[model samples]
Every structure is written in structure tokens, then in C-alpha cells.
Target chain A: SCYLIPNKMVPGDSNKECTDLKGNKHPLNSRWQTENCDECDCLEKEISCCSLVAIPVGYDKDNCQKIFKQEDCKYIVVEKKDPNKTCDVSQWI
Target chain B: SCYLIPNKMVPGDSNKECTDLKGNKHPLNSRWQTENCDECDCLEKEISCCSLVAIPVGYDKDNCQKIFKQEDCKYIVVEKKDPNKTCDVSQWI
Candidate 1:
């Protein structure tokens, strides 16, 4: 469920930290969510990130559409034609 | 992010499997989600379960209410009076 990225640093730098895709520096043991909504942890040797959003996989894909809401790290499944209406879908891991 | 439950078994049983809260048995290395949307893995000594649904923490609680949809394992933040309206809120880890 999570991906690991080896920690890389400047050649002359001595500090140990994780750098995110946006070039944000985080101290070891720190946790954060990326702009892409990936929940990441700054570990000793690498950065581990897992998706905070779960894409709708069991929905009626033909008649429904999945929209990602970045502000909340969630997905909304609604009718394709009438987005105001939510579509019922089975839940899965 | 996950909680571990020690694997318990019958006094005379020898198989190594995890028994979930619902009394379902899962073999080692197997993974599943509970009825409550907890993603779980059956490990060697315990069952690790993490909530698949992330509760809205940075939302406007005064003007919005979070409605949990059991069918989809997600929360919908809507207006206090008009449930059809979605409220804008800041994102947080």
C-alpha cells in the first residue's frame, strides 16, 4: 500500500532528511501528506508514502464518474450526467 | 496507522490464522477489509488493521457535518442545513 524512495541529499550536506516531490525538506521521523495527497513518512534511510485517497473501483463505471477532491484527499462518485446525485457502489479493499 | 490484535485460537488448535472481530478466520499473509472499512492483514503473530476511511479533521465543523457512507467507506462533508451542498474546507494530514 506504500512506496519507498531512497533518501538523497546534496553532496556536501550532512543532515539527514527526506525531500518531497515539491522539494520540501522534512526531518527524520516526520510525517506529511504530499500535494498529490500521498501520506508520507520521513524515515532514517528512505521516505515512505501511501495514497490517502482510495479510488472508487466497484462503482458503475459506465454511468458514474469518480472525481478527486484534492482538498480533502477523497473521491466522489456521482452520476455522469447528473453529478448532483451520488451513485451507489459496493465497497472493496 | 494500524492496530495489531494478537492472534488467538482454540486451546487445541494448531493452525496459525487470525480471527477477526466478526469471528472470521484468515490464514497467514492474507489480507481483507472489515465491515467497518478497516483494511487488515493477517500476519504471523497478529492481525494488523488500519481504518480505510480518513475522518475529516480540518473541516468547518460549525457549518458542515460529516456523513459517513457505510456502503463506500467514505465521509461526505455537507452543509449543516442543506445536505446537498458540499462545504469547502482545508486539507490536513
Candidate 2:
């Protein structure tokens, strides 16, 4: 799976980069982009980099709390597909 | 070494969480109060979260460009202490 996160656009190119699940790419430094990110559905820097840990919306308010409660758990940014809060965060790199 | 990032305060306890550079901590759920973050030096949410990448200020404008040229490069966020535009990005969860 390839996840691309758009950047906040510092001063240069407002481009998006995606790589294999292994985090490796062909051209190496992310200069050679496959698709014209501009063609993507999202807008500008709004679609930049993927959130390091995509926090689920209703995570604590629903599911996790029932199982973990105030036990305090390590933060894990895993993809959530339950019917709870259904956080839809499609991140790019 | 622990690099804790203060978050953009969403409406709860304004605290900071620091983990080992290896990305692990003792009491996970991050509720334990190791230290009152207020005791630290920085300001409010400004210290909340750490940048996923502490982009070196002089990164492309100096070093890497000399070696990799305009061919494009992979984005690797590393702690920079160079003479050039050194970027100090202390990130957190």
C-alpha cells in the first residue's frame, strides 16, 4: 500500500510523494513523481503530509474506552474501520 | 533521550509527553503525570507537539544540493546541527 502526504508548501514545489509499504522508491529523493498530484481530488497544502498517527475521532469516546477505560494506553495510529466514530483520514506523503 | 511535543490544546489537560528516542514509554496511555509540563521553559501549545520532520533550514540551500543536485531527493527528517540553516524541530505526540 502506498500512502502520500502533502506538505505545507514551504517555499518551493507543492508536490506529493508516495512510496511502497517498505518506504522505498525508485528515484530515491522523491523528485520523480508518478501521478500529477494536482490531479488528485484534494486541494493544496490541505492534503500534504500524512498525519504520523491518524487519531481516530470517537476512539476514546466509544470503543477503546469500553475496553481500556482510564487504564492509559500507548498511542497507536492504526487504521480504524469500526462503526464507532468512523474517522476518515486519507493521508498522503 | 526524550523529545516531547506539546499538542495544539484541543480542550483537555495541557500536558506534555516524552518518550524514549526508541519510541517507547513506561506507562503507555500517556495519562501519568511524570512532571507538570508547566515547569518547562517554552510557552503554551507552542510546545505541545513536535514536528514530524525537523526540516533543516539549510538542507537544500546548502549541503544536500551539492551532493544530490536538482534531481530530487527523498525526504528524511533528521536532527540537524550544521553551520547552515539548522532547523530545530522538537516533536511530540
Candidate 3:
């Protein structure tokens, strides 16, 4: 299940802790979130995540290379300099 | 301002609605969620999302093609047949 911890509760050490809908305290720096098929680490106030799914079947090697050239390939390209960068939740604050 | 709606509360229509910490109701099928740099649609019980960030600045055309190779390239590959697919929350249920 996903947990929605407030940005404020994430960086401070206090009795006021964030919790999931179940009311369980969501600890800081916990690897508790998932996105798509990838697991994520819940850091100070962000979720650092990445996927490890292999290239699509049949579209391997040269085939994958060829497909990557098509205009539609733009949709699949990873534009982030670091695709695994932490997703700052502080922005929501 | 992320909402922690229970998976059960997501699929049905009732007086029991989900809300963020602010106590505002999180409507179903709303484009209210986001991941990484992408906005997402909050569907019946899932988050349908995708990224629109342009394929990195410098690494365009042939340069991007070259980087698509190499073992480390696997780290940035988008392997989901459809990366824009909805993330089913039922699994969390």
C-alpha cells in the first residue's frame, strides 16, 4: 500500500509523525513506496525511485535500437539526466 | 498535499470519500496525482500517469542513440510496453 506523509513531518524529529491510512507511522528514509513496476525509497521528503524491468521481449538488441529511432520513441526516452533521482515532495509544501 | 486514500475507498461511490490531510475530498478519476516529473490521473482505483519531459537537452539524436547502448544504459531504459499504463491500486488492497 502507498503512504502519504506530509513534507513537514518528514524532515523533523518529533512526536508528530506521518502515517499511512492505516495510522501506522511512516518512518523517514524508508523504502516503502513503489511507482509503476519500480520500488522507491522514501527519503527526507521525497521518493527516490527507479525501474529495473528488462527491455521488451522480442524488441531486443538491434530491434530495440531500430524502434528507438522512430518519432514515437520520443515518448519512451528517459529525459532525466538521472532517471533515478529523488522525487522531491517538498514541492508540495 | 498528497492524499492517502484507502484502496477500498477508491473503487466505490459512497458518503465515505477519501481526503488529504487537509480534509479535502479526493475525487475519483481526477488528475490529482503526480510522480517524478509527470502528472497523473487518479482513476477508479489506480493512477494513470506518464512523463512528458523532453529527451534530455544535450543528448539528442545520434548522441542519445550512442548512450542508449552500454550496460549502464539499462538503468535508464523504459521497459514497460506502455509506460503510460495505469498503476492499479487494487494490488495494494
Candidate 4:
């Protein structure tokens, strides 16, 4: 879901554009994906973001690791010692 | 991805089971889905939870609303004024 990151109150700016945490400005009503894979909206007073990827968790952390698939915007659980081997992921969030 | 919610440091307890925030005890290595749709794992020191559903965001919030489908563990963007009409979802997290 979307979570709003409130903008630092600027004394007189009531514009619809938004400024992200990185200090990058985006035009009003614009939508973009961050470098960290969060889809964000440029609102009037806040920057709203939602994760674009679902992370796989609840796996055997001792033997498995989660890897991000940048192309698909999701994660895969695999054997830590062998990337080619898949691991059982109990859940994703 | 998994987010750890550390349990209160209870003195003298080193058990393998975990006590959730709701005070529910779960055995170590056991995984369960919470009523809120989060998939959690019972670890020794903390409860690790992952969201099982990808929430739709970046939609026209002023005109559309999100509806959760429990059976499918996903969300649908629909017209706020008319649930029967589908809305365009800009992204899902």
C-alpha cells in the first residue's frame, strides 16, 4: 500500500509538485519508480511510495538467500551456496 | 520482504518459541498467516513478517478505491462511486 512521507513544511509553497527524500523534485501528478524500486506519486504536500517488489521471506536463512530480480521486480529464494538452486520460500511480502 | 518486530526482552527466557505482539505463542520455525494477511515466522528472538498481498497504489485515489480479495490475497482498484467499474491501477506493491 501507499505510505505518505510528509514533506518538510516550506513556508509558502502550496504547489502540487513533490520533493522526494533525495531532494529530487517531481512535477505534479507525475508517477515514477525510485532507484530502490519504490513506485511513487508526486502529490501536493507529500511523496507517496509503494514498494514495487514483493520480497520472499520465511525461508531457511541459514541455507538460503533472497535475490532480487530487477527485470521482474520480485525476489527469489535460492540456496546461499548455490545460486542455481532454488529454496522453498514460505512467504512473500 | 521481512520486517522484524522485536519482542520485549523478557528476563530469563531463552526458549525457541516466539510470542507475538498479540501474546500468541508460536513454535520455532513455524509459519503462519495473520488475520491482517501478513505471513509471519516464529523465530527465537523476534517475529518476522512479510506481506502476502501486493497492494495497489498510484491509482486515482480521488476517484477510485482499493478492494482486497482475501481468497486471492490481492487487491483490485475499483471506481469509488461504482464498485462494478474497474479503475486503472498505476502500480502495485
Per residue, candidate 1 scores C-alpha lDDT tens digits across B24-67 of 78988999976446788888756767778775657877887665
- Candidate 3 chain B worst ten-residue window by lDDT: B66-75
Candidate 4 CAPRI-style tier: incorrect
Q: TM-scores for all candidates?
A: 0.45, 0.18, 0.26, 0.49
Model 2's TM-score against the true structure: 0.18
lDDT of each: 0.68, 0.28, 0.32, 0.70
Steric clash pairs (candidate 4): A93-B51
Cα deviation at A46, candidate 2, in Å, is 21
Evaluated on CA atoms against the true complex, candidate 2 attains a DockQ of 0.04
Worst 10 residues of 1 chain A by lDDT: A1-10
Name the TM-score of candidate 1: 0.45
For this target, which candidate reaches the highest lDDT against the unseen true structure?
Answer: 4
Candidate 3 has which clashing residue pairs, if any?
Answer: none
**Least accurate 10 contiguous residues by lDDT in model 4 chain A:** A1-10
C-alpha DockQ for predicted model 4: 0.03
How much lDDT does candidate 1 score? 0.68
Writing each residue's lDDT as its tens digit, candidate 4 over B26-77 gives: 8888999864366988777656788787867578988876655545667777
How many pairs of residues collide in each model?
A: 0, 23, 0, 1
Better model by TM-score, 3 or 4?
4
Pick the winner on lDDT between candidates 2 and 3.
3
Off by over 4 Å in 2: A1-53, A61-93, B1-84
